[model samples]
Target: MTLDEQLKQLAIEAQCHLAKTPERQRSLSRLISIICQSNKLVRPFQGQFQGVYEEIYAEAQQRLFLYLCKEIDRYNPELEVMQWANFLMKKRFFIEASRDLLPTIPKGVDRSRIKRSPLEVLEKQTPIASQVNASLTEEIIQCIQEDHDRLFQTTHIEHKPAANFQYIALQFLAGYSWKEISEELDVKVVTLSSFYGRCLTKFAPKFKAYLSQ
Candidate 1:
């Protein structure tokens, strides 16, 4: 069977288990495990939170499991299970990250004496190290956004190549996979991967400088 057929089958089975009471817990847990195993959902969080990646990954997985159980009834069998699972995983990561960054007051301390996470403190300082890290993130984001915009605009380039660049930006900067872009654009996976590699090669120098900023 094709990948699409397999995903649809998994979705159907998951929906069936979700609707039934006796096998619900076991089946849902199995389905969640399968989804987690099939996708590298934590890759996007690694570069941004390198020091705390393990914590973030554990939190994201736990939250995703809970969320899938809570929203199982709303699962759409027509959609790919892994895709939806990855989407929820990314959402959970951001939610957990934000929660972690929130200032908290100690039991006996005043609200003004709230403690901040290391990330928050780092962002607030004006040291050279902090400035370089902040500048790198800002510049990379700006450069990617500019490239994304240019790809979408009318330019003196072939339509296919322009579209390929836009898809590459979406994959790298937007955390999409080649498979997802292929499905969306109705292009073959091999073609998209090849073009994406070319795009990366072309942008390697600029990206290197941004990372070193």
Candidate 2:
């Protein structure tokens, strides 16, 4: 059988067993082992920082596995298993590797909530929360939404006609995580991420110029 068939069988079999049962545990273990062995998942995890990157990846991977274990029932059969896992990994863990860079704020300040400083924005590629004001954020939102020249409208993820750049930018800038956007668009998170990254690289100058004016 093909890999997807195998994954489907394994996922279904694992789901059939009780959450903490030996059968379920074995099946889940087998699933992840296969994923790693196949190298179907991205590895050495792409990160912004060379140092401490692997460390964060390791931690994020462990967390991802745990998340999958508890939430395996939610795994959709229509999608490729590895793609779903990779989406979760990249959405939740990949960028999370940057946590290592955000250690400037002192601990024990407040458990309820805390805000990042401007320095943290420079240190990591995160949501522009700390970098821009409310009006600036709204301005970006409006520019992408207007699509007067269809620049954003014309750009889309290859093979996915509905997944336009404007939609992705609005959702992303509106603070949707890659995983969430992936679910909404029914597109692979990796593809969306690659497209988003390319758009940022290509359009950053325009974005900056827009903000300056």
Per-model TM-score, in order, reads 0.40, 0.46
For model 1, how does the per-residue alpha-carbon lDDT over 82-111 read when each residue is reduced to its tens digit?
A: 667777666444444334433342233234
Candidate 1 — which residues are off by over 4 angstroms? 1-7, 17-20, 101-213
For each candidate, the alpha-carbon lDDT, in order, equals: 0.48, 0.61
For model 1 the local lDDT of residue 146 reads 72
Error of 1 at 182 (Å): 41
Q: Which digits, one per residue and each the tens of the lDDT, describe model 2 over residues 43-161?
A: 53343444544545554554465556666888888888888888877655544534433464233323223344666445345553223321224455677788788998889987787
Off by over 4 Å in 2: 43-47, 100-213
RMSD of every prediction: 18.4, 19.0
Steric overlap count per candidate: 0, 0
